[model samples]
Every structure is written in structure tokens, then in C-alpha cells.
Target: MNIAIGCDDAAVELKNTLAKHLESLGYEYTDYSQPAEDESNLYADVAARVAYSVAEHKHERGIIICGTGIGVSIMANKVPGIRAALCHDVFSAIRARKSNGAQIITMGARVIGSELAKTILENWLQADQIDPSSLPKVQRINEIEDSILSKSE
Candidate 1:
């Protein structure tokens, strides 16, 4: 599956590590990360880019990173139809996809090491299909999103 990956300056190293891991796993991915020197490269912007890419079906999934992962997760979820989950463990990563049908996963560079991040990504990748029983829950989530969006419009 093609993956969209991005990070802010604070998580550049972790992003690089994950990029290499994706390569080793034979998964095709595109990096949307901005140069560290770019003063306008905000975490929220990068997160939105990745989130929109996945939401538009430009990529199958996405991985976004920041110092604490919280900023990116919040920003990504702001986009309609995007379910971005901040996951620091393998179980959360798996459940993000299997239970929530999340198309994007956020990680914290300062919170987890490269090895653990790789392990989490591996498990998340393996969980390509959501649990069948979670369909109703996922549908409800979509309905809620649509409701909120329609109200705002």
C-alpha cells in the first residue's frame, strides 16, 4: 500500500527512521515533510497535507509525527472524513486501523524510540483490514462527521 508520511522539524529524525523502515518493508511511500530550514513548516500544515492526501484517496494511509504527536493528531482530525489516531504502542496502532478504521497514525518523536516506532508501524501495516463488527461503529463516525460538517456549512 502507498503511504503518505510527514513530520515537523522536531520529528525529522524519527520521520527519517520510519521512512527507512517503510523502504525495508517494501512499501511505497511519499514524504511530504518540509525542509527543517523552512520557517513556515508548521506541524499542523504537514498533518493536514497528509490527512488530505489520504482522505482524497491519493494514498492508502498516512504517518504523521511531531514532538508530542498531539498537535498533528488534532489538526489531522479536523479534516472531514479523516480519522487520525495518536498511537504510541502496537496495540493502539492495530486498534486504530481495526477498530476505528483510521487512515492516518500519529507518533511522538520525543515519546518513543525508533525501534519501537518501527514495531508499531509494522503492526499497523499488517492490520490492513478493519474488523467486520466495527463497520457500524465506523459508519456512525462518518455520519457524525457529516452532520457536523453540514451544520457548519
Candidate 2:
């Protein structure tokens, strides 16, 4: 699978770890942000670029990383058709893809270790929500989406 990976300075090391994981999993990826050296990294910029890339790529998945993960996730989710999920565990990662049909997974450098993150990514990349059991999961996620829209209106 072709993937896009982006991260800020705080997440550079974590991103590299994930890159290796992606390679091991027999996937190809393109990095879109963050210099090798520490810099004033902006989560919004990375999120915007990654979201745009995912939207353009259609079937490709994206992995975005930041310090707390929340900011980048929020930013990416702001884009129409982009379901960016900030997942810290395997279950949530699977849900992000299987339940919500998320095309992007966000992670926190300080929140999860490399090994655990790799496991979560593996589950995410392989998960499919087309099973009968996933209907309830999709329903629950749609309920949350409905609540968000209702509150916004």
C-alpha cells in the first residue's frame, strides 16, 4: 500500500520508527514534512498537507504525528472527507479504520512507545469494517457524528 507520513520535530524519531515498521510490513510511504533537524514545526501545516495528500490519493492511508497527537488530529479532521483519528492503542486504531472509515491515523510521540505504535499501525492497516460485526461499530460512530453536527447547528 502507498502511504503518507508526516510529523513535527517532536515526532520525527517516532515517525522514523513507523517508517521502518511500514517497510517491514511491505508498504511504501512518502514523507511530507519535518526536517531531520529540530525546527519550529507546525502541526497545522503538516496536518493540512497530509490531509490534502490523502484526499488526492483516494485509496492511500496517512499517518500523522505530533507531540500530543490531538492538535494534528483535530486539524486533519477539519478537512471534508477526512476522518483523522488520534489513536493511542490497538483497539482505537482498529476502530478508527473499521468503524469510522478513517483514512488517517494520528499518534503522540510522548504517549506511545515505538513497539506498541507499530502494533497499532499493523492492526490499522489490516483492519476491515465490512464484516457484519462492524455494523454496530459504524452505527455508534455515526451516532457520534450526528451529535457533533447537531451541536454545531
Candidate 3:
């Protein structure tokens, strides 16, 4: 599946590591990461780009990173029809896709080591299908998002 990947300056190294891992796994991915020297690109902006790409179906999934992961996850989830999960472990990564049907996963560079990040990414990538029981929960999430968005409009 095609993937969208991005990161802020604080997580450039981790992003690079993940990019290489994606390559090794034979998955195609587009990089939206800002250059380390360019501090002008905000994490929220990066997260939005990846989230929109996935929401629009231009990519099957996305991976976004920041120093703490929280910022990007929050920003990505703000977009309509996007579920971005901040995952630091394999179980969370798997559940993010299988349970929540998350199209995007966010990671923290400072919080986890590179090897662990790769392992988490691998599990998330392999979690292609959502669990049957999670269909209702996932639908409810979509319903809630639609309701909130419609009310705002």
C-alpha cells in the first residue's frame, strides 16, 4: 500500500530510519518531512498534509512524527475523516488499525528507540484488516465525527 510519511525537525532522524525500514519492507511511501535545517514547517502543518492525503485516498495510510508524537496526532485528528493514533508500542500500533481503523499512526522520536519504532511500524503495516467486532465502534467514531462536523458547519 502507498503510505504518506512526515516529521518535524525534532524527529528527522527517526523519520529517516522509518523511511528506510519502509523501503526495506517493499512498501511505497511519500515523504512530506521538512528538512532538518528548515525549522519553519510546523508539526501541525505536516500532520495535516499527511492526514489529508490519506483522507482523500491518495494514500492508503500515513505515518507522522514529532518530538512527543502528541502534537501531530492531535492535529491530524482535527481533520475530517481522519483517525490518527499516537502509538509507542506494537500492541497500540496493531489496535490502532485493527480496532479504530486508524489510517494514520504518529510516533515520538524522543520517547522510543529506533529499533522499537521499526518493530512497531512493521506490526502496524501488517495489520491490514480491522477486527470484525470493531466495525460498530469504528462506525460510531465516524458518526461522531460527522455529527460534530455538521454541527460546526
TM-score of each: 0.95, 0.81, 0.95
Off by over 4 Å in 2: 35-40, 131-153
What lDDT would candidate 2 get against the real structure?
Answer: 0.86
What are the RMSD figures for all models against the true structure?
A: 1.9, 4.3, 2.3
* Prediction 3 global C-alpha lDDT: 0.94
Candidate 1 global lDDT: 0.94
Q: Among all windows of ten consecutive residues in candidate 1, which has the lowest summed lDDT?
A: 32-41
Query: Candidate 2 lDDT, tens digit per residue, 31-50?
Result: 97764364445888888888
Query: Per model, how many backbone clashes are there?
Result: 0, 0, 0
lDDT of each: 0.94, 0.86, 0.94
lDDT of 2 at 127: 86
The TM-score of predicted model 1 comes to 0.95
Q: Which stretches of candidate 3 lie over 4 Å from their true place?
A: 35-40
Candidate 1, superposed: residue stretches over 4 Å from native:
35-39
Put down candidate 1 lDDT per residue, 1-153, tens digits, no spaces: 999999999999999999999999999999988734554679988998899889999999999999999999999999888999999999999999999999999999999999999999999989988899998999999998889999999
